[model samples]
Target: MSLDRHILSFLRALVSSRERKVATAGVVIGILYLLNWSQRKTSAKISLGHRSKKSNKGTVDLEFFKRIIELIKIVVPSWRSLEMFNLVLLSALLIARTLLSISISSVNGRIVKAIVTRDFNLFMKRIIQLAMFAIPASMVNSGLDYLNHKLAIQFRAKMAYYLNQKYLTGLIYYQMSNLDNRIANPDQRFTQDIDKWASCLSNLYSNITKPCLDIFLFSRKLSDLVGAEGPIFIIGWYFLSGIIIKFITPPFGLLTAQEQQNEGLYRACQSDLVNHSEEIAFYRGNDWEKRRINNTLDKIVKHINDILTKRFFMGTFDSMLVKYGATMTSYGVLGLPVFGPNREKYFARIGNDPSSITRDYIRNSSLLINLAKAIGRLVVSYKDLQSLAGYTTLIHEAKVVLEDLANGKYQRTMMEGAVYDQKSRGTYIIADYIKFENVPVVSPNGDLLIERLSFTIKPGMHTFIQGPNGCGKSSLFRILGELWPLFSGTVYKPPMEQLFYIPQRPYLPHGSLREQIIYPHSREQMEKLGYNDEYLENLMRIVRLEDIIEKRGGFEQVEDWNDTLSGGQKQKVAMCRLLYHKPKFAILDECTSAVSMDVEGSIYQHYKDNGITLITVSHRESLLKYHNHILKFDGEGGWNFYTILPDS
Candidate 1:
């Protein structure tokens, strides 16, 4: 009976053990399965993120890096240039600052050791050394700031010059505004965007360069003091944290770009208001203008607020991980050399002196803290880098658009019922005489203003063009001046220098009365052409603007001429300018409308006497005697030419 009982107990015990083992194996497999599922979920999220990033317009990707490289070349230019030399000098200062930091850390340790050991003389000596070191340290810091600002200014100058060269060369500025619809508010881009980009780029170089050097030097020092494991472990922790932060970081680059764009729009709205304040007031459209400006302002504010909201949450996590968490980790690393398993080995070099141990602890602590801070700065710079990417995207887009315009490639939003054919382009020929052969007058929006208009005007053959509003009147001049692209046929006109255009609203620049007459030509240029202010005075007298010169000031006096001059006076100034240049052909588009009929006829007679051929667009019958030929538009893609009788 006893043997049977023993056999039953043994079998029951064996069964219980096997059940426990099976249950343990099931739990293990369940945990592994959960881990696999989590990993797949994370991988799917990352993949989705990459895909979404590619589609985002302002994403900082490989293309952004390439753009950065290209822009950097523009900012830096050459290794032998002044900018490069400044960079090299700045680098030297960075290295010097790092060396000074190391020395200060050592001196700090000695002072602490002296104080603990009650050695007043040694403490005094170390204190004197620290004070002496501070002078160069201060200079190095100041030098860094000065160099950074200087580099920023230099960078902006180079970039602005490059862009201006492209913008102002050959009718590009006009085409950019009138023909292409890609870039908005190029004025804002030149002034604000470029400045911000250059400043950010300059600061970014120092921010990144200094931190890297600090990390390398401090890491080396820490490794020597507390074994390679301490620096390696802390660095690895930061590396892991950086990766985690990257995943949590929002698309700051895209947000910054959007914010800048909205800011530009807001500025443009205000500029438009200022430029047309007189017209708006005349129409009592202040309320409407206010609403338009406020709407733009609201958009900018909303975007900026969104950025701030995101930054708030991001800043909290960043502070916790990079600041407080790093502090705790630093403490742990610092304690390892003193209280860890190999603590005795670390103490053997200086014996068991408390002062020596405290000194070593302070120095090691400084080194460790510096390493952590360096890593933290590197992590923080990711945000600045993203912001830089945003500016880079904007400036690069402007550059691409400018280059495209220079190459005669344009993209415009077509008007309804407009026709555009990419393969069809008009022909432009440079000749001494003006002629159009089957040339279709098309607006920038591809509107067919005149299907096939043909006309010719040789020098001394003054012609008058009469047409209804929007009946391809100014469109013809635009085509002739190359402001609007020709769709088909041929156009023969004089070189731009030999052709002058005078609109009803004369453009009086910000300069003296002399400049108003010889505009686009400086005093030196006027002198080079063997002309003087006296010559300009004579031309002004011909336009009846003689007394106005002394009334305002001398010829060298400067003012906002557009605002200061009356409507008639402004027109007279334009006529004076036309006489000054005395081009072969003048396209006067209602230029003398502001002047009285007497003065107007006299100005026309003056132009005719100067041997300048006039292509006038006007409705004034009184001036018909000045023109010998007439070209009339029927406002429906048709035109006719007739010779005016001598009596009429």
Candidate 2:
């Protein structure tokens, strides 16, 4: 895509997302309205009026609006002059939101009722009926909702994955470990918050769109009942009510953000114990850790209480909404007689004999009541919507990193799957034959580690990395593997498919031995990697697992891997998997450290025979003979590279 088109695509996607949110919000509201409306039969209303007590007149029945203004002046004198504006705007929105909520709840109620009654056919038909109205609107809303959520998740996951990948990239992980905890618990943000934000994104999207949708769709349906002029007045009331809510609510977004951070921070302290329970027991730091965790918890809870206080103040507007709702009823009392003729007037409203006009008058009054009830719900929902906006902003902050990670420029690559066309060979390469320059990896805060790291291991060149503990050997390995970016320099490799990074403790997913063997590679790719049934069988035997395979499972049948395998057996299985992949260079970050020296030697020997370039990190003196050279980091930023000879 062209630059402009890509930008447009992104914007259009976002706008489309917002539109969907609005729509889904509407559908939920609509469904609620329908269900709620179904249960509620309009009760017979008595046309009670505000009697005007004057010098000559005994009791003149004033219309709804006069009663409204009187009530508004009495309750909130601040809204006295702008009472008409207040009632017109505030009341309608309040009513509309309420109506929508009622509708949604009612629809939900009906759906629930249908399920409860086991009246599937009626439920289905009711669903079908609502679906006709809701589906299209919901489709738009749901589509928007899905898009928004997907964008959010994509954004969140990308950032988290990126930061995670970046933090591990250039020994930034080591730096982050040492950095003062400004971000008290980053793991909370990465693992839990990113996931929670991603997962709850749909709900957040709905929260926004649903209320606005309630306002719009509810207004649409309500306007149909109330007429165009009525909607105008109603919207005016809605607007006024919204403004009041805005005035009452401070920018709680920052507060909410802080609260989440604090909560995560507190959780992080608790999680530390859970993750290190064995270590705590081993060291007998039980009281220390508990005290430490509790201190963190206390800090978090303190912030939470403060946030709740802010929320409580902002929420006091509900009382205001209730007051305005009563005022709107007053306006309705005034409006009735003013709009209709003298025959429709309240003084002559009741007759000795009840007639059809009396019935119509009663019906109108009830419609007015229904309209009023809807207004109240709309107002309350608006306040809630404002509250959720804070969460939405936090969600947006997460998206930034996610987008960059997922689509940012390609970094140092060491592997490529076979590209059929030689014409495409020169396309992606930045410089000449894949090189690794002096790369200094650092954090976003500019903390540095492992500087002047320049090493180029060409294809089929087996090299090993040796360093003392915490000298960033694994970090360098991570950089070499392309999981972490080189902060300053470049790592050039053929493509993504030609190399593999094997860690100290290889990750074993909960699956069969067969499944575990080809963990990341797809089934088709597993075949391409030359890891079929027979190849796997021979490899298992090579790893001394022929008896285990035969006794437990041939190929098709297998037990749960974690439950079945011993620690040594798991290590051997990992070695077998490494052989099966057959990548050009395998960067092993102490992968075989758990195995005995003899088994480790055999695994290395297998690599030598296969001609696979081996880049390994190990403290063991026994494994050095397999590699032609060793790149050693001396804790300081300095690194020494030298050729080693076994026979020297």
Candidate 3:
């Protein structure tokens, strides 16, 4: 065979075989690996630059602009449907206001003409026309403003609802807060920042649109009087002012975001002081706390001062340009006809009558000046425009962070942590067996806490999980609860509802005593479930919380339960909740630490009698009698599972 025929025969043979396909894939992967190795050997720095260059490219992409437009569309809904009737109504009012604005300008011009001509009849008629126009103009302006206020409230409510849905979905709040901590004071962003954004948006729509409309409408009138040169001069002035303002303006967006973060930090410090008042008071760290708070306050003040300083300079420049420069530019443009070739023609039209000619000149000059001033005011409000930009940028970034989290990018980061079971669904459920199959526990920062851990607790088999702090004891529970992602294995457990986790410090929401017991369920829900005072009284008696009902009046009374309940009392309430729900598996992390041994013992026995499997974590040797199995962590990635003997 010829060389070409031999090569063709080999190619056909390779295409025809399964093994050859596998070999082809291997070769391609090897080539890619070699290429990566070559790049690494040649220049690791340039290899790293590939990632950063991608990020830099994204910053200036159309997606960011599209996000902005989408956000604005969310804030200001279109008038396409019956649901947008309010916006349609608002638009009508805005159009009415625009018409009134034009009328007001025209009336001012007529009043000037009436004065210069000095016709008493014409002057009186013009005065009455001005009065009538002013009445409706003021009414329209106020009515439009009132309508805008309502629209703003509605818009804000809708936007807040959408953002709240995103922020609170799944474990989004927890992931954003604990796992990433990228968005600061998401609470304030939803409340204060959203409020500000709504207000800015309302004003921005009106301020930007109305000025542009007025400039266009008035410029036409000015053109009719002083030719196109008058409006051209004012437009040129605006362009010049925009250039100067853009150059002088600071990075207001970054500054505003920093200000918000500082505010959250300062507020957090104050909140900590309040929440841990007893701890701080016991330590007598009032002076230290004062200094810390003062330092935070100092930071807040410094940021505000920086903002104000920038604004001060901007204000000075804006005032000079708008107040004085606008007037001079207007007069300069108006005086062109008087000094130029048009002077002889302008006087000849009035037959050498200086008064009539001067009167016409005055009326036209005033009209031109007013037109210039309106446009100038828009240019001067550029600071507010910058501030609006700042708010939108922060909101957009937050939106991006939230979307990334929902897409599981943060949770699935290879070097950072575990790959979560993204397809897992359904609420908490406890099956007949709770099993871990070669599960490895890793921290959020990817440190191995436990490795290849396999264990199973069958029905009626109570287990005591023993480990030193930071040995992944509590973290193991987090993975089972699906709060933390699993590393390299599956944890076959019941759904969330059938598994209950009781932390050391129980969460006590402010409500009636009855609400505290059956919580995560409302009084209304309990009532619907056929629960009554007598039933609740029975549950409390079982948990030995009967005294609490007597001391706090009745179950109907509402108070700050966290403050009112003692540590032991809180734990007892949690037990009552546990017994009330009666889950198949309960993970108690030192939940009975505050309670007396007698009460703790009773609670454990009650769970055993109820056929609820217990996974308990505690330092006390007192809890051993209630369990059959022991899972001990060696403070390394090693764990041991053993049976608890009757004597030992």
Top TM-score model = 1
lDDT by residue (1-648, candidate 2, tens digit) is: 444575588678867787778867866985675454333211101111121121101111243224323322332345333333433343344334444444543454455556655778978976875565564445444454455555455545544655566555543444333322233455665676556444443344345444554546545653443344554665566567666665444334444555677687678677878867778899999889889878877877876775575556445445545455445643544344434234234345444323323433343344444444445555555434333343333433333333333443321222244212111111123332245576664432344556556676765566778777767776665555554545555766755566776776567776666777776666688887555788888888777776777777566665777557777777777888877777777878777777888878877888778877788887787777788778888887778877785411
When superposed on Cα atoms, how far off is each prediction in RMSD? 8.7, 20.7, 19.3
- Taking all chains together, the TM-score of candidate 1 against the true structure is 0.90
Q: Tens digit of lDDT per residue, candidate 3, span 244-356?
A: 76655554544565677688789878988998898999999999999999999999999889678656655665766666677778876777555444666766766876556
Please give the RMSD of candidate 1 to the true structure: 8.7
In model 3, residue pairs whose N, Cα or C atoms come closer than 3 Å (at least 3 residues apart or on different chains), thus clashing, are 427-496, 428-495, 428-496, 428-497, 429-494, 429-495, 429-496
Tell me the TM-score of each prediction against the true structure.
Answer: 0.90, 0.59, 0.81
Could you tell me how far off, in angstroms, the CA of residue 627 lies in candidate 3 after the best superposition?
2.2
Regions more than 4 Å wrong, model 3: 1-64, 76-78, 81-91, 109-125, 278-288, 334-370, 411-431, 550-553, 645-648
Best of the two (1, 2) by lDDT: 1
Q: lDDT (CA) for every model shown?
A: 0.85, 0.55, 0.74
Scanning candidate 1 in windows of ten residues, the lowest lDDT window is: 36-45
Error of 2 at 487 (Å): 4.5
